[model samples]
Target: MKDLKGKVALITGGTKGIGYGVAEALLRQGLKVVITSRDENAANEAADSLASKTNSKGAVIGVQADVRRLDSQKEAVNQALSTFGQLDIVIANAGLGHFGSIEELTVEQWNDVIDTNLSGVFNSIKASVDALKESKGYYITISSLAGTNFFAGGSAYNASKFGVTGFTQAVMLDLRQYGVKVSTIMPGSVSTHFNGNEPSDKGAWKIQIEDMGELVVDLLKMNPRTLPSKIEIRPTTPPSK
Candidate 1:
């Protein structure tokens, strides 16, 4: 961690949004990255774009994998090991939201949200825990402010994120003995395409994807003796309601 050069990271749902941004940041820091997406084209395209935009000192490759399935996650970890020779970081950043009152929420929506947000984190960790233990690496999960704060119509998302926050903290305790670090980032009002919203200038006041990327880099560079287990980030300012 102190010396990040050539370290390997496996990021789930890295084709765009926070995952893509973090990949770019790690590449800029001279780390090799494996970014996964369920879509093959998006994954490859993102890898190519990141590689082209950053200096060649750090390498990046994209693989197709779904965090919801343990087998798929295992394949992604295997791909990272085969290509980069080691896995030092794991970022579970894949998630989705479906907002509605519980009375109107569909079983399908609830399943999708829980499967991708909660179980997905578990699959990602389960797939890479051994590799991380071997490397004594870091595992970071992208939860949400919703994890801690609840609102009407946020039942499914709130449940999943709350689970993620608690799950990650417990994992930190479980993994620390092995020298693997674990942390979760919960952010509010980020400018990205989440839940069908598009990113544009209007969202300039929101937390930017690059900001999340920077935070992840800082976590990676921190002293090994210190661990910031849970972090909540929000925009410095927002329009007056």
Candidate 2:
């Protein structure tokens, strides 16, 4: 909390979207970042791009990991420590969405959403808890407004995000005593290439990835006595019906 410079952060699903934005923001703040993705090529490419964008050499590391697997999360944590020598922040940003009515949703798809969006966070925190405890670090999760708002086709996605919101709040209570901060950032309608959509100026009305990145930085800068356990951010204006 005292300083972010020279701090190390490990972000899952950081090759693109919100995760990528956060990596860029932190790197600009002089933090070493470890970005993880399921694809080795994508992870490496993202790390390289982040370094280039920030004009920071070797400050961004890439680890190929699938958040669904606890071992993969642990490997990412190990890589962050091995490469950067210490970890002060962990971002559980890996997530997936499978939208369908309860009747139309398959068991496999349901499991995928729950595992990646909910359990993935638990695994990431578990892997980094020891290091975070030692460093008095921060744990952040990128949730969604859908966590609290339910829609007809969002059965699986809603359940997962709702679980994340509740889980993160409980974790905040559990970890605050150790000086490790925990928070969940829930954004509504971000203009990222999430699901199958592309990010373009056409969707500019939605929240920008960079905006979310800045929010992360703001949370990191807060005084240790204050913890915003859950944050819900929405566009100031929405498209008319």
For each candidate, the alpha-carbon lDDT, in order, equals: 0.95, 0.93
What digit string (tens of lDDT, one per residue) describes model 2 on residues 88-127? Answer: 9999999989997888999999999999999999999999
Which 10-residue window in model 1 sums to the lowest lDDT? Answer: 53-62
Clashing pairs in 2: none
* Best candidate (score: lDDT): 1
Clashes of each: 0, 0
RMSD of each: 1.0, 0.7
Instruction: Tell me the TM-score of each prediction against the true structure.
Output: 0.98, 0.98
- Segments of candidate 2 deviating more than 4 angstroms: none
